[model samples]
Target: MPMSEEAKALRRVYQREYRRTHPEQLKRQRECTRQWQRQHPEKCREYQRRYWERKAAQENK
Candidate 1:
């Protein structure tokens, strides 16, 4: 089903708010993740394992 006009307007407001607040946080998170992956491959593997576990659960549902 298509989104209603009110839903679309709300999405626009939410998108703008998120862009203002989240870009720096996301950039920092990416930098930290990359540093972790570089410094500790084993720790990165554990993160990947949990990521796949979550993906599997979502797919099953």
Candidate 2:
């Protein structure tokens, strides 16, 4: 089932508070993401290219 807007908003607030109180966890998460990107440079570049292409297409609409 899909969450209602209020439920989604509350979840977002909870996540923001959790991240605010867990700096180390956020740092580790970012480090893990960076490591994955380093191991898949070509994939990351392709993803970025596609992302910008979509963004540009949306802007032109």
Candidate 3:
């Protein structure tokens, strides 16, 4: 099921509060993300190429 706007807002507030109290967790998450990107360079390039293609198509429409 899709989240309601209020539900999404509550989630954002909760995430913001969690991050405020969890610096180490956030640091670990960022490090994991960087490691994944380094290990999946081709996948990242393909994702970026598709993202730009979709964005340009949207702008031209």
Q: lDDT value for candidate 3?
A: 0.99
Stretches off by above 4 angstroms in model 2 are 1-5
Q: What Cα-based lDDT does every candidate model obtain?
A: 0.93, 0.99, 0.99
lDDT of 2 by residue, 1-61 (tens): 9999999999999999999999999999999999999999999999999999999999999
For model 1, residues 13-60, the per-residue Cα lDDT tens digits are 998999898999879989997897899999888988999999999999
Q: State the TM-score for model 2.
A: 0.77
lDDT score of model 2? Answer: 0.99
What would the per-residue lDDT of candidate 3 be over residues 31-60, giving only the tens digit for each residue?
999999999999999999999999999999
Better-scoring candidate (TM-score), 2 or 3: 3
- The most accurate candidate by TM-score is 3
Candidate with the larger TM-score of 1 and 2: 2
Candidate order by TM-score, highest to lowest?
3, 2, 1
